[model samples]
Target: MHIAEGYLPPLHAVAWTAASAPFVVHGVRVLTREVREHPESTLLLGASGAFTFVLSALKIPSVTGSCSHPTGTGLGAILFRPPVMAVLGTITLLFQALLLAHGGLTTLGANVFSMAVVGPWVGYGLYRLVRRLGLPLMVAVFAGAFAADLSTYCVTSVQLALAFPDPGSGVPGALAKFGGIFAVTQIPLAVSEGLLTVLVMRLLSQSSAGELIRLGVFARGNARQDGQQGDEQGQDRQRKRVA
Candidate 1:
């Protein structure tokens, strides 16, 4: 969810911008390292950024100058991890701010924290956890996307509450108001995003398994297999870790 242009107070805007800068800088380093190691990731990274821009642009308007939207972070977060998604997510938000007049420049940091950093990290963590538990790939992916969208809104609600506390009720009341607004629109969108992400992942698996394999998701799955196959895959993971 975007806080919209000039919705947040200047203090809040400046604080969030400062807070998000470190993550964005670190993401740049991570992206540089990954691209150096695998030049092929350039196309994938661009596509990921494009995906985020398109999906996030399909946003639903809400009260208090905010809006709910499908954060397309989960799929990329699963594939490239949150740090990489952080960079792509920022690019997507910046594009939207400039071209679409969606989120504001001042609120860029807050938006990034919610949609990029928080959502992707939450999604990636859940995906990794579910995969480790040997769940079906589809199930893990869907849950990750669904949860990521919800988490983004949750953070957005918090940001809004922090920025505009009700005089009588304060931040908690404002949080409920914002959260209520988001819940009405965000739940179904999150589900849709999950299904969409699953479709995309399936397409990627079919058309670009090699790329996914390079990302190490497949290796992790194979490492869960029983007996000698698992042993060899585990050894391979160890080697990758060492390298």
Candidate 2:
């Protein structure tokens, strides 16, 4: 979902940069708190960065003459926290631009704003909301992934509308054209991403990595902690009987 260089006008670029500044600052502050709270978790955050990098690097051709890649921000947000996902996403996009030419340096700020800031926040927010509502883990994962994809496209549409306000036609016409083309590719991609995210979350929930549940990674309720406590109590009872 990289908007090629020159697609956005100078005014739009400046606007996006200005709008994204607060998010960047907030993300940094959040990451700092996380580092202080759980210093060892930094290792996991770095691993998340690598995971995002790999996920974004793999592309699938779409019908819009462009390609789509897994954002992976939902997974990262679920694992480390949304702010950590933002940092990792920025790093991954920078590396992609410099090394693979997947996106342009000039449009890096815009790209970061849309994909990293908008997408991850949307996904993470939805995940948190659903978890609070006691939804199933898989359902939350799907919702998060779907929101992330749709938010990215909405950002893209805004960027396009701002850039080409009047391509001989009105702003509405331009937006329609841009949204139409993007929607064609984004719809199927969103569905695929939703399914994949649900599957991965389910797998993680079942694996030894289920410690993620304790860390508030998945959208599971506090029941996981209660269950762990109950199991510990049962184990203690068994030990007492043996003694």
Candidate 3:
């Protein structure tokens, strides 16, 4: 959810910015180290950022000052970890603010805190938890992606409720209203995003098997299987070329 510019009160905006700045700074450092140490990972990093940008840019009218959409943070968080996602999410929000006007500069911090910070961490946490519980890889991926999308909306609802509390009923009342409104669209959207993320991960497992293994997405046994499959495909291609 992109909170429109100037929608949050001035004091609230400043507080959010302060809250988000440290995370963003830490993310930058982590990203730089990743690229410098593993130059080949650059392409995947770009792809992750693009994935978040494209998916999050698609917004549907939901709440008064915000809209509901897929966070697309889970994939990156799973691939590169949550610290890297904080940076990617911030960059995604910044560009969307400047070009699409989907979110505003004044409210960028609040938006980033919700979609970039809390969402990725929650998703990554669930992913690890499920994987630890002996679930399948794709199952864990779906759970993580679903959690990420839903959590973003939950945080946004809290942010909105806090900023513009109901005059009569106060913060709790405002929270119920915003949370209810968001749940209608957000739940289905989270499910769709989860499935889509699983599909993408499957494709990556096929095409970028080595990279996935290095990133710890695939195990050594899977790597051996992938290597054997690669050898077969290479032999087939050579035979065709000779013919």
**Candidate number achieving the greatest lDDT relative to the actual structure:** 3
Candidate 3 wrong stretches, greater than 4 Å = 38-44, 57-69, 221-243
Candidate 1 steric clashes: 0
User: Where does candidate 2 have its weakest 10-residue lDDT segment?
Assistant: 223-232
- TM-score of every candidate relative to the true structure: 0.82, 0.81, 0.84
- For residue 196, model 2's alpha carbon misses the true position, in angstroms, by 0.6
Worst 10 residues of 3 by lDDT: 223-232
How much is 53 displaced in model 1, in angstroms? Answer: 2.4
In angstroms, how far off is 145's CA in candidate 2? 0.3
lDDT (tens digit, per residue) of candidate 3 on 1-243: 799998999999999999989999999998889889989768888887887788676664443445556678888789878998999999899999988888899999999999889989999999999989988888999999999988989999999999989998999999999999988878877887798788777666656655676777667676655332345475465446445
- In model 1, pairs of residues that clash are none
lDDT (C-alpha) at residue 36 in model 1:
98
Q: Record all residue pairs in model 3 with backbone atoms less than 3 Å apart, i.e. clashing.
A: none
lDDT of model number 3: 0.83
lDDT of 2 by residue, 83-144 (tens): 66667777888888888877676687788898888888898899879878987767788988
lDDT of 1 by residue, 146-228 (tens): 88988999999999999889788999999999899878878877887888788777655544545566776676455333111
lDDT of each: 0.81, 0.74, 0.83
- Worst 10-residue stretch by lDDT in candidate 1? 223-232
- Kindly provide the TM-score of model 3 when superposed on the true structure, using C-alpha atoms: 0.84
Indicate which candidate wins on TM-score: 3
Candidate that beats the other on TM-score, 2 or 3, i.e. the better one = 3
